[model samples]
Target: MSPSRIMSRAIVLGFLFFLSAPLLSQSLTDEAATIDQLETRLKAADKEAVTAAMTVWVDRVRSKEAELVALVEKRSSVEGDEKSRLEEQIDALRTERDALADKAMVIVKAAKAQGVDGADANEAFLSGLSTHLDLKDPNALLTFALNWIKSPQGGIKWGLNILAFFAIIIGFKILSRIAGKVVAKTMKASRMQVSDLLRDFFINTVRKTVYFIGIMMALGQIGIDIGPLLAGIGVMGFVVGFALQGTLSNFASGIMILLYRPYDIGDVVSAAGATGKVTAMSLVSTTLTTPDNQIVVIPNSSIWGGVITNITGNDTRRVDLVFGIGYDDDIGLALRVLEDIVTKHPKVLESPAPVVQLHELADSSVNFVVRPWSKTSDYWTVYWDITKEVKERFDKEGLSIPYPQQDIHLHGLPTDAA
Candidate 1:
């Protein structure tokens, strides 16, 4: 609380302030030295040297541009589209490099005009600009391109594109498989006589069309040009069509067969020297499997143009059987027995009564015709049954079934011999 004590405190504070002043001054001196060092380094750059380097760079760019143009032109003459495309790329690169050189020259000129060293000023300016642009410090365009080649969404975008492409392929495959299954199932479910070839053709055509569209879409997504591909296919198709006239005719006939189903699968037909069940029918050929397990392939055109005998078309069929009786036997009794045997047959149709007729007078027998109407499925049984039963019944009734015999008189020869 005394004045002396207050004075002593003030002196201690003043001493401390004095000691701190040297430290502060040293700090200020260090900062000033750093600034001067920066200025000195900045002033040491040679503007003339940088200007010369810039001129050399510009000349190099121009020379490279000229060489690229010449090469592109030569390549373009040798190979049309690819060479032209390469030339375009070269021109773009040359233009970009030229612009970069021009920008560098401008920076150098501005620095020189401001009385600032070109190299150091330009270097500092480029460093600051690169930082702002978030570019690497190499200052090499190739390095820049390599470093920033990808887009902002590069990995995800590329993955998505690839995934989409695969997905489309898989989807098309699945669709094709499903379409085939559906076709098969539909054919199996329906009672119509559809050929395997017809079903396959329909399913395959639809699947191929769907797959073609899917492939085109996927290619477009991946940046492919389908215009040239389509044109090439069209030209190739025209050429092929011109060469194969018979094949085209066959194809047309096949289409006609599919549209107008004269005979279906499993139909027993006689055509093209082949009598068998229809196994497969295609655009080009029809396959028949004979009862002997032999496969025969016949052209669709042959089948379309030839006679087709569908043996199993109707639900019911008529069986004709011939039997003969001796002229000495009772003809009325024989006819009655034949008619009775056919009428009692289980498979014979009663709606139209079975017919028994005295067909013809043969050399030694009275020929009787037995006509029995039976289901198509029971044709063989009914035919065999009617023939067998008629003979047995006539025998039981004491009506003799006759064999061909000749009553020849050897009167002239015998009289001459006697």
Candidate 2:
């Protein structure tokens, strides 16, 4: 019983083991098949993702190329006007673009040659660009500018345009200096205030206007439109002119004063309610120093329009004195005394011939008008000497100088009493 039982158990165990081995082997094959299917699917997904990424990169490169081409067209179109300048700019930009492209191509090829994966190379390029371009620092701006200059878009040309702007500013400054010197020299030789002031004003205004044009030209070089800027300036100038009408009037008057030499420096003039020697004159006002040593400023309009009495215009002047005496005094004796006084005075001019006439007879006195000719320098001295000598002679001769007398009669109460 033990042998048969043991043999039956052995047969059952062998049958069970044989059946489980085929099942286990089949299960192992199924698991291997599933693993192979998953691996194949993963490989296909990787390939698709790579293709999509590469397509995106290629599209980006195409877009960039289109932009560069448009820039090139613009550069070419500008060649006709300011041809030399525009050509220089275009060439510089084209050189910059080529260099960048060549460098980028080299980097890509070298990376690829070194077995850098496509994704890695693209990522590196994008990261490098982000760090280098559009940074907030000046160095970043310069680097970005350099990159553009090397590009086909004429980035270098744009950079040079900025430099040209500074050069234009310098040129304008030089022009201003020259204009100023020219105006100054012209004024200095004229010995006039009005003309000098007007010339200066005109030159300054023109300088500012020309400088504005220079600015516009520079801006245009940098790809900016100057039309609006010019229009704005014109409108602003109109507004300013309207607001400063009085100022313009004075300026015009100043010009007239300069052109017409009515009064010069150090001329004594009575004008604009002021009597003084003209000192300095500008576009707006005339400066004067009065006899009392006071500084007075008068408007240009007053000088140009009002009466300007120049006291010192002539080199010689006349001094007249009225000598009056009593009607009873001897006229012949008076005339003789006056003649002596005139002959003795040193400042009396013999050429003009001094005349003493019995000019007027008043109610109380006979007036003798004594006319004496003298140089302006001797006017005061001769006048004083004649006056003093006349008094002395009249006193010595016992001749009387009369005073005004009013005669009045008192009427008695009518002969009513009679």
TM-score winner among the candidates? 2
TM-score of 1: 0.55
Q: In model 1, which regions exceed 4 Å deviation?
A: 1-148, 151-200, 217-225, 238-251, 405-418
Cα lDDT tens digits, model 1, 1-418, are 9999999999999998777655443332232234334234324334443344444444554465566556545643555566445544654554454444444544355356546544564544433322111133233344334433342223445667788998998898888788777877887888877666677787888788878888988877665788898899999999999998788888988888887777878777888888988888778888999989999999888888888787776788888888888889888888778877888888999966788899999998999888888888799999887778776777678888776788877655435555
What's the lDDT for residue 339 in model 1?
A: 78
Estimate, for each residue in 259-338, the C-alpha lDDT of model 2 and write its tens digit.
Answer: 77677777778888999888898877899999899999988887788888877677787888999899899998999999
For every model in order, what is the number of clashing pairs? 0, 11
TM-score against native, each model: 0.55, 0.57
* Poorest 10 consecutive residues by lDDT, candidate 2: 128-137
lDDT of each: 0.68, 0.68
